[model samples]
Target: MRSRLLFYWISSLLVSGCTRSGSPPALSFSGGLVVAQIVTDSLQLVDPTRQRRIPLVRYFPQPGRGSAHKLKVALLNHAYHGKNTDYKFLADNLVAHGYYVISIQHELPGDEPIAMTENLYQARYPNWERGVQTIRFVLQELAQRQPQLDWQHVLLMGHSNGGDMVMLLAQEHPELRQVQQLISFDNRRVPFPRRPYPRVLSLRSIDQFADAGVLPTPAEQTQFGIELVQLPTTIHNDMWDGATEAQKQQMNAAVSHFIEKK
Candidate 1:
């Protein structure tokens, strides 16, 4: 069923020329720069038994104003109460650095906290697999649309549960072969089902998830090939909170270095 849905999506995009038609119109960001949010009405596998419209939000840097270095990044949100707001600062920073950031809002029924928590389980929520499939499908769709994009440099960035999802997806869809990097922020430790690709960066706050003492085991960490980086003073919410200007800058700098480093 997953394979059939993916085939239909690719076929539709190819028939419609979703990427080659023309440059998508640019959107204005808070700063002077322009960003583009390309929405694709392609396939969305909602659950094991159902499919829905796939919604993707993207932030593309202004074209022709800067050097053409393309990096396709997918940012996934964390658990209950998770939304793009958590990654906007980081996404904006990545846009300034000349990378296109695409994030998917998970298919939780209602925005309420309790409803989201109930849907977190893989067994209970079969849509989790579909979400993973959607990410892979979107990567291909974006590559077809943006010719200048270096498809080889795709990166996956997620927070908390989203981070765990990306890890598991990367392990499962090795055939996609486009995702070269993985970044996780403040995620609880869960055993990785299989080895992730070579480049994996896991960043956690010092006393946050780590101090909680329920992260992946040392053996599991080794097996997953994670290059774990800990931020000593930064809290789990520091990335999203209204920290001081200087504090935000410090946090942004650390994250930027990790993403932009060769």
Candidate 2:
């Protein structure tokens, strides 16, 4: 059966939008600065077997300078209690730079609050486990809907609780190897997945410390080829839209560089 799509799509503005400004400069890509057209679509993927609905806010790259070629895919996960709409600033940035970005909503009303215990890694296992399942369902459905996209370079990015989902998804499903990279913004729980494939780049905040063992050691980082950069001015809460223009610019530069270097 075809997955039901609740389409509420809109063709917003053609950009030069890097920030929420009246008139920002043209955005830069790995190739260089270029004009790009982006569209936003709101939809949900129903998991009939699991009896769950995964809401999604898709930022699609239209035919323009950056998107004329095969567009790379980015799946964004929201933080605990955050709506899929929270990442528009980041999503728009990626879309301008030639990525087909889909921000996923993982939390549903009446769901149990995530644990804040000392042993968060194990205590919150169910939440993280369920997260990957929803993601898997979304990807399967998305492949059907957006078959022309470049899935092989699909990169997963999230902030705080959402960031934790990045590593867990790659860890649990090794065979889901199309994800070329993992970019997490201050995931506080669950140790970094120790694998060579699917490159890892974690942007850490200066104000918050991850749980013990959540971050890899210097040796482990080198062994695993992990790139961990600390953002001196950003805080845990500001990883989303709360970030200042300076903070967003720095974070954006780092993130853009990471995805483009390959």
Q: RMSD in angstroms, candidate 1?
A: 12.0
Query: Candidate 1 lDDT (Cα, whole model)?
Result: 0.54
TM-score of each: 0.64, 0.86
lDDT of 1 by residue, 1-262 (tens): 0000000111110000112135545533223444443222222323233354445556555445544345455555544356544555566666655566776766556422322444244342344455576676666666776667767767787776666567667667777576777777765533333455646766666455432233445565577655566555557766553544544555555555556566
Q: What is the lDDT, from 0 to 100, of the residue 142 in candidate 2?
A: 88
Indicate which candidate wins on lDDT: 2
TM-score between model 1 and native: 0.64
Q: Which lDDT tens digits does candidate 2 get at residues 1-262?
A: 0111112122232334433225445565665535444567789888999888888888864444453467778999988888898877778778766688999999998789889867788888889888888888888888888888887878899888888887788888889989888889889886778888788888887687887777777777779888787777778888887777667776776776677775
- CA-lDDT, candidates in order: 0.54, 0.76
- Which pairs in model 1 have colliding backbones? 19-145, 189-215, 189-216
By summed lDDT, the worst window of 10 consecutive residues in model 2 runs over 1-10
| Candidate 2 segments exceeding 4 Å error | 1-28, 31-34, 63-67
Global lDDT of model 2: 0.76
Off by over 4 Å in 1: 1-50, 74-79, 108-127, 192-196, 210-225, 241-247
> RMSD (Cα, Å) of candidate 2?
9.1
